[model samples]
Target: MHTVDHLETLCARAWPALAEVPLGNWWMRAAEGFTGRANSTLTCGDPGMPIPDALKLVQRFARDHGIKPTAHVVNGSPAESGVEAAGWRVDLDHPGGAESLVMTGPLEKFADGVVESRDLPGWWELTAGSEITTAQRHVLGSGPNVCFASIVVDGVVVAAVRGAVVEDVLHVARLAVRPSHRRQGLARRLMGELAGWGLTQGATTCVLQVAEHNEAAIRLYEELGCTEHHRYRYWIPAVS
Candidate 1:
């Protein structure tokens, strides 16, 4: 397939899975939401077009759906070009850093362990320190396509991850382990479990979006045999 075609195909397969939420903006929108809705590039054509045109199209689509446009571009390496041409500020984010060598597999073995359901109120109560608002959690969990899990130890929830299945791909979203449980390989185990669930539900492969600066996540994903697929540009036009 052509470049844009390939990107759209991937987006169509991954976006809904990434967010696993509806597009209604009863709550405010974040830049991350736009990427999750991206799948139109296939229809738009590749090299795509001028940056402004691409931005306009995406922005229009987002707006129509009550979503605010917060554009982002993701490329594999610093050497890659055309990212800027897509109207996004370029930045390199490494998701997984040096925390490699962790083992990954299904969550079945740990299923009997203290895995708990983390709904909006519960998750918000735990992560109120960060920017996670109640609406964000609701949008994430309200959908049938999405589910969130937290591993509890000693009656305290320590590690967590969210999974969304869209099309035939399962996208892993917002995975984190509490500071106390960082080095115990819980994240990997959780990922393995999430991947297993996705596979069982007809997901052919799993994908996720991580920032370039997050070395820890990048390292962990690399260790999991995840490869760089496509780069996306996130554009938030400066308001005139």
Candidate 2:
């Protein structure tokens, strides 16, 4: 469990938010309205200060950054109960915001070459949906350790994924497959390539975040030998 916590911390660093303010052992992150993981306060371990004081600081940090005061609490952690007791409500209304699982596995099982690294522009063209927002661009291209993986077929990119390696763990995100290319084992192949890339970069493990409601994706990852490491949910102050 402790090692899982440390791996998660490294994963957070890999896909960094736009702004991160340290509050004891917690990280108050802000990146507009991009994603909960990027905007919420990540309470990994003890804050080293009073919980109330830390909450106040988190509130102030969110307000200063013009984002809603939100906290990402590990499901079974002390912080979850504390924040809920303090009037913070789990953000169930947000799209797929209720519960997310952090899945982990070794990088040696999947076969390589199904995916290849590409530049930001090429990666975005293949992965981004019909429209791209400023916040999306920043979140996808923010970190230096990121690798943009894509699958090109018949001279056109169809499947893509992103991997960021930090502290021997590869954090995978932004996986997409074109509608015409779905159900062809593209996602699995892409993950295999990502695992291969991670191994070459000295990464021993791979992790990816998926909403609990995403049954298909969850099944796919499970079939690939990834198991849930932990769960987390976003908690926001109840509206007065």
Candidate 3:
């Protein structure tokens, strides 16, 4: 029963990656590096560019930046326009299913092994360090006004999940597990911990946004009983 207004606030607070994930700015933080915000439209992987240009832009962006760039096309734009106009084959827009639905619960009910504050910062650091794109890094690392949790194994930090309570809804931000520690159910454990925190923060429910193409992630969410809700159309103007 998460409302659109609530989700938007959650995205703004918890998942700054949606639109605020910093880009081209972090490189400035790095000595001798150049930074630029990810083009939201008309730059590359945008639906308004020519097909060949779109592909090339995508390839170049990924190659140079080490991250996949997505095109947010304006809905209702005729297939003959926008990305379609750009000469790219249209795959029926969202050939994928739908955005995942949100679920709410008491934090106490979800708490298991207990989430500790000592390990939270390190978990954030590791997760942020692993991001390939500046936007991803910003959300996971420097995004403003957020809360988080981390899981430790044998006294060693292994997994982490962060949530931001924005507009009374909890948006799960960065969730990460060490590559060497996969398949141990740590992520689920961390997610449970995050849910607990969300409830305490007055969040009515929790929401997460993931790429439609990420099958593995979608399956994991489904297994966790997360439902599919509405899909959001991501559109970047050819110039904006």
Residue 134 shift from truth in candidate 1, angstroms = 5.3
Alpha carbon lDDT of each predicted model: 0.49, 0.82, 0.49
| Residue lDDT tens for model 3, 116-146 | 4343546746666533465555555544446
In model 2, what lDDT does residue 44 have?
82
Point to the candidate with the largest lDDT. Answer: 2
Report the lDDT of model 1 for residue 226: 71
- TM-score for candidate 3: 0.57
Which ten residues in a row are the worst by lDDT in model 2?
Answer: 113-122
TM-score per model over all chains: 0.60, 0.92, 0.57
Return the number of clashes found in candidate 3: 12
The TM-score, computed over Cα atoms with residue i paired to residue i, of candidate 1 is: 0.60
Each prediction's RMSD over C-alphas, in Å, is 7.5, 1.9, 8.2
User: Between 2 and 3, whose TM-score is larger?
Assistant: 2
In model 3, state the lDDT of residue 49: 43
* Superposed model 1: Cα runs more than 4 Å off: 1-69, 73-134
